[model samples]
Target: MGATQKMTIFKLCILAGAALVGTMSVAAQAMTPAQTMLGDAPSVPKNIVIMIGDGMGPAYTSAYRYYKDNPDTQEIEQTVFDRLLVGTSSTYPARVSGYVTDSAAAATALATGVKSYNGAISVDINKQTIPTIMEKAKALGLATGVAVTSQINHATPAAFLSHNESRSNYDALAKSYLTTDTDVMLGGGKKYFPVSLIEKFQAKGYQYLSDFNQLDSIKQGKVIGLFANVQLPWAIDDNDKNKLSKMTAKALELLSQHDKGFVLLIEGSLIDWAGHNNDIVTAMGEMEEFANAIEVVEQYIRNNDNTLMLVTADHNTGGLSIGANGEYSWNTSIIRGVQASPDFIANDALIHDDWLARVSLNLGFEPNEDEASQLARARMQGKEVMTTSIKHLIDSRSNTGWTTGGHTGVDVQVFATGPAASLFAGYQDNTDIANKLISLLPKAKSKSQSNK
Candidate 1:
């Protein structure tokens, strides 16, 4: 779609909420008639792949696009996915949940088609159980997979396979994985899976793989792999390069092996993490990496033709925004830094330990022994040297404002292609996501398999 055309549709969706002057400049660009018409509902795809960009909102997407399109100014364009769509509300009862929503509640709406209070997972406000798209797809004999950049048991992924009163019930939720016939379970949260439950998975004949190398060895059946104790690294980290996309590709490869089509939920969970930390560089880099995974899926869909790819976020984090007027050059540098950073950096602790030294080395401004000693003493006292530096760096970068380091109630953007893409058009409740997916799946012969 042309820039103008894309902005028009974006404005339409934005208008569904309160009008903000901030969105007007973007909306002035008209979308192509063909691109706008592409929103028309298409045939149901045989395979449904939902890519959840947890905590990414329109603001984040716009920032990424701005840097990507303006590559002449020294900013490296780093994006794998091209098309875009505006996302909708995950609010419950429409007006009851207010405009803001949390990940757990937003994910529940996306997964089960019902919005609940904040912190609830896969259940409605009344604490009632709801059928998820994955469960429905399974009953139709479709293969299923859930891949995330956070703990596999995190709220977004867990909403697809497990239900609980609180999203924090990692131990209880970890065990529920055993009952679901989900074909591929990838990402972090190794600690939540008690030793006994890990053994139980083994007993159930699941091929438990701990590393990416082991993924190649699995030829059949279900596979559960946890790459970290909690959340995985940001895509900008060199240490985690290719692991997230690798897991996504592997899951697609294995799940496609089944005679029946598959449904995969791939989450770029750390874009939200970076947002919470107000790390623009990290957030943009992770978004680019996640887009790479989308490209992989897009290629698969192109060949398969029967697969639908849906890209969206559960909620917005940090309410990220880009200034209309800024030194385009600095934005370019930041974008280049993001593109240069490999998929996944070293863990935060390792970065913390060596970051100062590395920055000093690269900038040719190392502190003297006395200054270093003072910094070490400050660190020993639990003070942050890097935090202070980052704040200064951010203040110098842009006039962008942030209300909180937490998730916002803003509507996220959703982009879809292939079959049933029209179902995503217009302003719809988050629960509509579940209903739309159910409509796309083949109807089951038994009532238990059908969504009421």
Candidate 2:
């Protein structure tokens, strides 16, 4: 049979299975799509959590370990990543798009189990809408949510919850969310959502919030939280370094209330921003915040054994390397001393005549005469140049290296646990991850609801 014929048959089966579920016992209702398609299978998870560390490759994880290690200990400590390491996944997009995948394409493959062009969001190469796992889960009466450090309409979150020909269509992406059945969305994009649009969402019974402190006020029902105009402040510079973890915890508290289950997408979106800037200090801070969010999900999974959690990256950025300038050792002590992102430090320097003193205080070290002279010269040049100089100084001190400001084609590690996680235990393509998660979705009910 043709592929189209096969899909029709599959849909028919889902409809029939939905009918059978009404007559079956509660135990039978717990059967997953995999079990329905295949006679016998493992127990399906009640909840699914997928975490994406945007632009995090193998190098980022390795760098984070040393950055987080305790020098006082005789043995190196294990991170949440080391404890949950399972396999790796290749991050290449459609044949038309090249080997190095952008966030949109990579997220599309992870959300829909299909490959598309680099800028496409949940759409096939032909620009047709492709069904995402979120849509499928919502159709099956399960709660769906997205929490990230970036805006809710950003590439990673948009791919899972909406379809767009271009990821840059922010207004359309925001409008699309009004139609989706998503239960929770928390991030930074107040600028994109106007009062008129917010009113519409309120009419649909969705609570809209822009204050970061107000996240805890709403205990139940649908909510949209936009904390900043664009992406949240860099973790290194932000007052609340644990923002992502708090968002994850809030999403869980609301999503877990549904009887059927939920599927949530949480992203460390600013990790990619740090990678793009080649700022080691900022990258490490983002990694720690992301790790904190993982800890929250890990605890939730432990308390609720029926939930499965998967953590991976969209692609590697900056081609980050541990050592540079012919140095054999990387100095994590220097990185750990830095207190703010280069951008933040540079802006502060621009406003003060005592630029050198400010830089020294933030870096936690006094630069040598020659280094200080270069930083002073860059400050005279402008804020952009000053920021670059600060990053270079940190790279020199820490022996860090980066090949590019853009993404690199590299395989990313996959970590998983809980029910049916073994399917992700070996090397596979990015689409395979989505397919496995899709198989875990509860079969759709026979309601006349539209998933668009």
Candidate 3:
């Protein structure tokens, strides 16, 4: 057969398999109207908290469960936050143009209920701006907030709160936040907003707070806090002592003060960063900290029963492949030992040759002495060393393989437990999430009365 014929046959097989799987999943789990209306349908949730762990794929979630459930670690307590299902999306603008989605397009689907181009935000294929669920919720008298470990103007959070043609237009997007009535916005990206934009926010009745100390004074109304200039430090970084969870906890505290309830989107943005840099230690630590934030949300929902908490990711990154069956034995001690050593260099940073040599020594590997000497000299001259090879070596030694240092097409998982969670019982298009959320809102009269 010719190459074109073979390609055609392969695509047919894939379509057949997908159809069979979809039919089986639907047959196995059918929802009744009462079950579907558990949270929002019957009555709008008093509060909704959607947590996005950017680039958190099935591998990451499985790893988290393994560590949490392991008898030796007991890292986290058992809870009802365990049930999960896979999430899906037609992220590409055309069905024939199926491709792995970047954070921008995937988040646009989740936020605006539309699949847009890879770089588009809440705008549709024709570049028409769409009202995001956040905007709609705010219009309905529900207070809104967005918190992320990355720049607040990054693709994921910005998709819900801003509508620029490009995600790279951080400066303009940062300024747009002034027009939003979002109650408690907190995250990184101080540089995106110049002194003028800061002044604009202050003029618009927003109390701009840059430090965690100022959060305590925020009793109600709108507030914006920019902690770091860019993406925040990794959870393992000594500089991140304050931690991302602290910001999330504070946002939840303040948003809950609204009488009509609120909608807050919290993102573990650095998990994607670590994945892009192939930094296993940083990725694992961030995931743990994200779970800590989830615990806080779970506690709030447990007490307030009217709140709905949904946890998911925009897409998978790094195509993280766990375990090396015959090449290496996978054991907890081995993994821990590899992570404990200082020799495992992350490619995300620029280090000197002397530092590389020290890392090589710690890992019991003999690195190129000439290269090490050159790096040391460069460091003396205030030059940076590219540590790509060192990062690859460390990842190989740890037995954690990654297909590429980029996003993958694999579907991610979504876990939910609370009012309206039944709506998330099966595989769903990313846009379906937005539709379900909108359908859950109370009637217009109730919302208007709540505002009064």
Q: What is the C-alpha lDDT of each candidate?
A: 0.72, 0.92, 0.72
Residue-level lDDT tens digits of model 2 in 160-273: 999999999999999999999799999999989999999999999999988999998999999999999999999989888899999999999999999999999999999999
Instruction: Summarize candidate 1's per-residue lDDT along 130-187 as a digit string, tens digits.
Output: 8888888888899999999899999999989989989999989999989998889999
Pick by TM-score: 2 or 3, better one: 2
Error of 3 at 428 (Å): 0.9
- The clash numbers for all candidates, in the given order, read 16, 0, 0
Poorest 10 consecutive residues by lDDT, candidate 3: 340-349
- Report the CA-based lDDT of candidate 1 relative to the real structure: 0.72
- The candidate scoring highest on lDDT is 2
Runs in model 3 lying further than 4 Å from the true structure: 1-44, 67-97, 239-242, 325-328, 331-386, 446-452
How many clashing pairs in candidate 2?
0
| Clashing pairs for predicted structure model 2, backbone only | none
Q: What is the lDDT of residue 162 in candidate 1?
A: 84
Candidate 2 to truth, TM: 0.89
Best by TM-score: 2
